[model samples]
Target chain A: MSHISLFEFTQVVKKTLEKNLDPTYWVVAEIGELRIHPKGHCYLELIEKQGEKIVARMKATIWSYTFQNLNVWFEKITGTSLKSGMKILVNGEIQFHESYGLSLNIRDIDANYTLGEREKIKREVIMRLEKEGLIRMNKSLELPLVPQRIAVISSAHSAGYEDFSNQLANSAYQFHISLFAAEMQGKDGTKSVVEALKNIFKEIDLFDLVVILRGGGAQSDLDCFDTYLMGKAIARFPIPVVTGIGHERDETVADLVARTRLKTPTAVAEFLLNGMRSYEESLLRSYERMIGHTQHRLLNESNRINHAATGIKSLSHQLIRDVDSLLRIQQQHIFDTIQHLQKQNDTQIDHLTGRLSLGLKSNLVRSQQQIYGYEQFFHFSDPEYTLQRGFTYTTIDGKSLNKQEAPTIGQVLETMTLDSTIKSKIEEVK
Target chain B: MAKELSYKDALEELEAIAHQIENDEPDIDELSALVKKAKELIQLCKKKLKKTGSEIDDAMKELED
Candidate 1:
């Protein structure tokens, strides 16, 4: 309690440190807090830690002129902004002030060391996930063929989420999208994203995949994605996770473990729409092939049918001609038969008539000859014929001499001649 | 008399010969000559009738074929 003024004590400490500690010595420390002053200076609280406890802490400053150039060079090389939680190798001088207390004036910082430290932490996260067998877990899940149901993890008003939904809508594919709004940067980023993922998992059956999206921003803003818990969550998710945290240069641990890593949120949308488009194109190709094959077969069949019909038609015509000619020949045969029968009838009638005439003539001649012989015989036997031959006979009283005993003297005698008749009186018998 | 006379003409000549013998009172020489001519006519008629019948049989057989 017997001390001089605070200024005198601060002066004594500052001189002592300037004499003992080397000027512009390089020191390794972590930035526990960082801020920019209105006067264009950078202020940082540097710390050395063992786990969550800080064993050493120091106030450090970068002059505005140095900070302007240094900040640009660091961000250009590391693709990250100077931010809290970053391990840095810096060259600086230690000094003490009466009003403000002890501080370090940083003249230079090695951006590569900060970048390498971040890379080392990212490497450790990846290794831990790998050892737990979670690195390939989400990747092994089969992405749905369509992938239309999407759970989006992003800030509510971010252009990243808008670009993704708009991209899908423009593709004209129906998408079932649900927004799980979350802070995507700063202190609450990792925790908020993890919470969104948890919420999505609560209704896992409803979503085909999850999308973690952010618009292009300071590379350091993506530092939250490099955390072990963030990487682990993505690696172990039941559904596939797609990352589109838009940073041109650096890749975060979350990006590495996600099922798909795209440079931007719009690019993620394109990837999904392109996959569906290719699938649809393949189906269209198969349909065209089927139609072509069917039409080709039908054409061949029609040609064969036409050929067979032509063959049948020709054969039918030939058969008809053959039948018609046969009918004509039969008709001529029938006509000839009729003419021959008529001729036969005429010949039979003529022959029969000649035979009848011959028979009648012969019978008439035979009868006439018989009659002539009979007439001759009768003329020889007649008495009138004998008288003409000089033969005579006498009668008495019209009786023969044989009829009377003797001729009486009074009886009259009669005589007959061939041409003349004799009247005689019956007297005696001859 | 024509030797080639048809059957009708030959029979008519035979009848005429009989009538001359009966109605004209011919002598024996004339009767015998007439009778001889009638016999010739009758033979010719019989031969002609037989030829005609054979010709008709051949014609009938040809028609059947």
Candidate 2:
């Protein structure tokens, strides 16, 4: 009973695993220590980590045919280049090998499922960064006033590389960018890109932004960007990364971790150029506004000065005209007084002649007519008539009010008539 | 409302929108709609990214334990 056959032992092991493990299950892990046997067999060790601790571990293998088909299918569906340290989901038959212990014989893989898992993982990481305030901690990388120095990562002959370099060169701005060519596809691509990035970081003093460019590659080539290693690297990098992996419907891990993720290398170039253009436009607008404001202020001041000058001219002219009119009125009054005095003198002389002799009667009649003329002049000069006809004069501060003798309260009070001063006070308080 | 699509799904939708905007024969109206959709998709993306980020942090803390 103790002597068991090797076949029986092997059968027991297989049966036990089949009974213990679910027939259909999902496993999420990072691809690690992958190796391909010469016999067209692919062997891999899958590992999952929680922080620094290895929480999950498994050995996995795929036959040559299965591996090839799975690889092609994954590439076609996800456009991701698969490699070590790539986060993946495996849906496969769990098998127990007697000789090799327990190992998962992977039958199929779902690229979308793994991508979803990766996203979930990425969200968790971002949240942690936020909680720790690390999201903004690495945010102090200054954008160059003119982003001229570029560190480019891509295949040497890649269309993306060519487009990036060409567009930058042909641009109005002549940028100084250095190219670091690496594989942009397959397992080796991830390693090469990481190495190139490290080197770029070492010489980071020479560059402004790091551009990871891949142009027009099949979705299969995109796996390099989807790798966990790539994402983690970009996330912790010292410089800002701009990813343009050139896929329409897929975003890689690298894209998630990048500061800017554009659809293509050409788009990245266009974005940079647009930034510069906008800055220039802003400066021009501010300059124009400044000039307009200055001109407006100057014009306003000039108008104010002209208006003030015109006002002073009008006031001076009016004052001068008023003084001339007063002078004419005074001269006419003096001439009238002299003419009356001459008429009075003639009348007195003619009356004396009449008394003296009959021969002078005619002269006396002439003098009488002159006396009549003088009477008319005296009537014109009568102050009593002028004062009786509602015309009154005032001396010093006091003037004619609405009533003959009504005084304006709160004024310096004084009064006069044409001949003499009838000095009086406001006799009653009322 | 649509089950709040997962980050990967939203990202795919965003990419589709971006492609439509990029390839359409320079139609301003169509491109504008696509851009609007793309912006929404970006919002969805940021939300999912934040969630996943937290999940990772939790996992990391658990590992540290």
Candidate 3:
């Protein structure tokens, strides 16, 4: 003992730990602090967590050869930069030196297995949210047209948020919009958005919708949106949600649950505008139809009037001929009754003529009333109207809708005039 | 007349209302009715916007910490 150096003492201790442990592979516990040495070496300090017990602690090192090779592979395969907060299962040999303290030299690292373990943890979190049935809650909320009040979960400083805000503001359609700024990605993002949702729910009635808008990124970077905490919060939100996260190419759980899923922030604006246009189109179509029908009815009534006038003229001519024939009959009958017979025949003829004249007058009045009734049924602007008031209508599928139906580009539309049909194609829309 | 609106109905109606208001020629008689509807919609919108503002305020407060 007197001749032994500090290293020699550690060698005896290392031998004791190796032999007494009697473990082919020992499982140890520690709060590992990883470090990279200037000499291209990786180091870790494993310490036990307890009440000042310091139950065990050890130093471990991986040479440059192993560290560099493993790091490159890990980054390439997982698409994640390897760093702290990651626990790794390592294999190596134990050694003790007289000058240096005890150290474990790492030989191989199973990064694949570590990645798998991380995925398992992620899956567990997802499953928990799914089981709670909160995943679809936010999306189930109905989306408002020009959604006025929106809780936006996104990074305030991010370009995506700016794009969303600007696009919404500059939209052809106007909405009273508000933003609930949130962290949209990274480790802190999920927590931030969750908190935002909680605060929003406290005054739930105030919001028409919530929008989760994140910009496109690498696939691996998209995992944060797919996280359980974020998904659950989005699902359980009290209002309708619109998601403009990433691109149309990739689908997120948030997209699935949202009331509307849009590819980008600009697309979200388009969706709202389109919804508003549909209603406007319907109303316009209704107005057009009202005018069209009014004109059509007036035309039908005019045709009826012309036909009645022709019939009245023919009847008048026949009546005139009948009066002449009656005068001749009066003369013939007068001989049978002498002077008394002629006077009686003339009186009888006058009575019959008066009855025929009254019938014609009543027929003219009835036709006039019928025409007036038709005008009232349709109720155009004026009782007596003409067709040249620039009336037009649009039809799709042989049926017409009000101004509310704003058909998309390339939609076949038929615009009808009082006397013509104009077929036009929608060349472009702003 | 401000059409009676449920939450879902209000959203759908509002969408139509916004478009109709934007595109159609203003009818003097129907304008009052539409304006009344728009006022109610503004209320709904205000309520929603205020809620989001509050949430953002809360988040900002937390970030300040």
Candidate 4:
């Protein structure tokens, strides 16, 4: 067999491919490798496989102008840029270059197909995670009431980081923030975030939550957040993870796997601050409850004391009144007894007076009889009897003289015997 | 008083005392003592709320070291 020169053979093959193959053919393939040239062209190695076996492979190109339009349109519809591992439905032309060999010149891509493929992959990842019970693992973690210790995963100089730090620093409560710097987007984003997570895991006890932060960007910039590896890492992390990737539209796999998902870095900080504020409010509530309970208790105590005091006062008053009544009754009894005794004594005195009066009257009657008899005797023994019996009486100075009497000089004396009377002048007598 | 009690414990005790005072109608002496204890617990809780600073350890520095 006569073989033509290799270059001539390639030229013939290129011409034949151009003449026979359709200028534009729709193809379905997976992007195995992809590179974007600095001059704005895209090169891709496309492959079709059956199970683990690659059945077909081809080199593909998209010129800069075509690539720019297609990229924008694809991303607009699918919310992601074309990247390796994405299955795409593309419109391309079969080309055989004399020097570059067989390739496909891609003219257009179906954004809906790629979108569907991405959804299918995402669904598969979610299903696998659900089956393994990992999808809800981080979400089920109980965040502390006050999650003050934070492990931050973000680009060191990202605006998201700045926003997060500023918001947290301005919060009413202090938070302990330790930044574990990581790339926030592009192909390396997932790996950097996973690595940061691993670092935080080394000292898991020191952190309450892991915050993955990124600022707002094109929706395609969030493609890294949907990767299975990052989702798995966040889902299985010991500490709860909070994501604030600043994507307003899509809920990435990282968001679903994390414990909490806020829309922005500032929102995440607000969430944390709100948590602390609620705790503080609860504390204040407890304080208020305690004060209310104490005041209620004190008021009750005061009321009880007043009640007891009133009870004692009234009881003492009743006791005093009862005693007073008892004393009065006793006084009346004693008065009655004294009055009875006085009446009895008065009656006895009257009886004794009557008896004494009777005795005196009888004695007086007996003494009167004796006096009568003595009087009669005395009258019978009068001086007449004596005179009749020759008895004489003598007197000096009208006073009778006896044998022991002596006369005084210059004084008249009288003597009487019975009825006869005599007067005598003073005479010396011895 | 020398043995330190945690804020939660102090609040718990305060709650218990309040309940006892409310329900039992304790005598004056016991009531006064309970009131004084509740006051101390309130102070302890307030102090905890007013705590000014926090202790932070950067474990990332350990990795750098």
Highest DockQ: which candidate? 1
Docking class of 2: incorrect
Per residue, candidate 2 scores C-alpha lDDT tens digits across A1-430 of 5778997989887888788879966777788768888987889899988887888889998889998888888876665546677778887778777788778888888798766766677666666655654454324455666777889998899878888888878988868888888888776878999989998989989988888888975755565566666766676678788888888765666776688889999999998898788877888998999999999988998899889889888888888888878887887777777777766765665554444344444444454444344334334334454556656554324333332355544544354444555655454445
Poorest lDDT segment (10 consecutive residues) of candidate 4 chain A: A374-383
lDDT of 2 at A7: 76
Decide which is better by TM-score, 1 or 3: 1
List ranges where model 3 is wrong by over 4 Å.
Answer: A1-5, A13-76, A83-111, A145-149, A175-177, A202-206, A216-227, A244-430, B1-65
Backbone clashes for every candidate come to 17, 17, 23, 10
Cα lDDT tens digits, model 4, A230-343, are: 899999998889999987666889999999999899999989988998899999999999999999999999999999999999999999999999999999999999999988
Q: Which ten residues in a row have the lowest lDDT in candidate 2 chain A?
A: A395-404
Better of 2 and 3 by lDDT: 2
Highest-TM-score candidate: 4
- Give per-model TM-scores: 0.60, 0.46, 0.47, 0.65
Per prediction, fnat is 0.00, 0.00, 0.00, 0.00
| Of candidates 4 and 2, the better by TM-score | 4
The sequence of per-residue lDDT tens digits that candidate 3 reaches over residues A1-430 is 4588776777788789878753434334342677788988988876665775767778877798888987777656554544544545667676666567677777766666656756665667667767888766765665664466667777666667777778767766666665667777656767877787787888778777777777645434445566776777677766777888865434555675566788877677667667778767877898899989989989999889988988888888898789878977887676566867756866675565555445644654454454344333323322122234776656665555454466678877787666887888777756
Ranking the candidates on lDDT from highest down gives 1, 4, 2, 3
